[model samples]
Target: MAPARKKVVIEGSVSCVYCVMEGGPGSVIKTDLLPGAVVKLQCNNSRKGSWEEQTKTGGKGDFSFTPVKVSSRGAHKCRVFLVSSPRGVCPLIISDGAVLKPAPPNATSPFQLFTLQPLYFYPAPYTCL
Candidate 1:
């Protein structure tokens, strides 16, 4: 029998700012994730600086922070926390923030948010069988 393959996963994203600054809309949430999971957006921008924001998914299998504060810095990461999923997944904080404007509070989606990942989910590759 073929070796049991672990599903390709990305999760419980967290990181520490080595030498960084949060520009405008910093990394706040996971916009795409494995299905049947609860993606949680959490971060520690500074030792004392703190902010709280949240939004849930509806089995849509995609995550993204809405109404984020767009940012640009040397190394500050906008990471994702895979709240309730398998571990050792890819770093949701894949790269630096995009040069796009953040979503307005009156917006309905993350379309305009400055994102590091593709705003759309291609779930066809990962089937949780």
Candidate 2:
């Protein structure tokens, strides 16, 4: 008989920072939380093959994938990508994704939680007069 694989949880968020260049240099004006943004989680390993999963950001720009059972080797090969932005909200210029790395296991929990750096969207280009 084979042993049951351990379960793990992955989560992260998406946000946008507005930068304005009035005279000398550009500066970030404000940061906004993006909701309803689509995020995709992909995992690939030469031995186990590959798979993908997706979820949308909540009202607070938070997104989480359901607990999944993955081997230790497969967990390190996962990555999170920004799939799409909410229509009429923020448009993405670059869609570079982040690699998923395993964090230290929690002493109280049986499963592991993985978090990625917050994905960002570039604001539409603006012309300065």
Candidate 3:
């Protein structure tokens, strides 16, 4: 008999920072939540191979993928990437995708929740000055 697949939910958020005279004595940094930003989640499993899913951030910069059913080991191999930004002023510079981390197991829930570090963006070069 085959084992039943497990359900998983992935969640994350995006943010941006505008730095004026960065690294200087009087430098200033402004941070804001990014809404309507697009992000993508990709996962790989030995049995089903690999797949991708995409979603946009909410008004509060939060995003969550629909529940996905996969082998018990599949949820551990997923990554989240920042795709697009709503503000052209805050272009993605030196952005890196984040690996998903599963929260501690819970007895009351049938699905696992995976989280990624908040992705960030910065204003264009020389624009924040």
Candidate 4:
């Protein structure tokens, strides 16, 4: 018999900086909406195979992927990666689970963003390996 599978949902947002004076560090005086950005999620399947899912940011720079499945006796993880920008000019940048603080009138509000955490499943002691 097969064990029950678990479902997990992964989501996040993307944004870009604005108002640059002298290029170096902290050049961005503020941030604006980066709509239509691509966000990808990668994980391992039960067969030890690689799998990836993608989603696009909306006007609010929000994106979400379908639920991922996990089986017993295996591990699954979905890591978020910045794929591309909306304007095709700016490149993708990996964020440390934190989004850029957007300015007013379309600024992305601060929220509790979650990072990818590895999901592990274990079999029963009485069950065979």
Q: Point to the candidate with the largest lDDT.
A: 3
Off by over 4 Å in 1: 1-36, 68-75, 85-129
Position 9, candidate 1: lDDT: 17
- Cα TM-score of candidate 2: 0.76
Deviation in Å, model 1, residue 73 alpha carbon: 4.8
Find the candidate with the highest TM-score and give its number.
3
* Winner by lDDT between candidate 3 and candidate 2: 3
Evaluation by lDDT, superior candidate among 2 and 4: 2
Of 2 and 4, the candidate ahead on TM-score is 2
Per-residue lDDT of model 4, residues 9-58, tens digit only: 34555666433345522344445566787776666565657776678888
List TM-scores for all candidates, in order: 0.32, 0.76, 0.80, 0.53
Ten-residue segment with the worst summed lDDT in candidate 4? 118-127
* Candidate 2 clashes between residue pairs 3 or more apart in a chain or in different chains: none
How would you encode candidate 3's per-residue C-alpha lDDT over 22-124 as one tens digit per residue? 4632344666899998888877766777888889999999999854544345767777888888898777545556987877767677777788777876776
Q: Cα RMSD (Å) between model 4 and the true structure?
A: 16.8
Q: lDDT, candidate 4, residue 68?
A: 41
Cα error, residue 16 of model 4, in Å, equals: 1.0
* Residue 47, model 3: Cα distance from true site in angstroms: 2.7
lDDT per residue (tens digit) for residues 14-115 in model 2: 876455355311354655788898888888777767888888999999998753636544677888888888854356535557866667777677667777
| CA lDDT for candidate 4 | 0.47
Pull out the clashing pairs in model 4: none
* Number of colliding residue pairs in each model: 15, 0, 0, 0
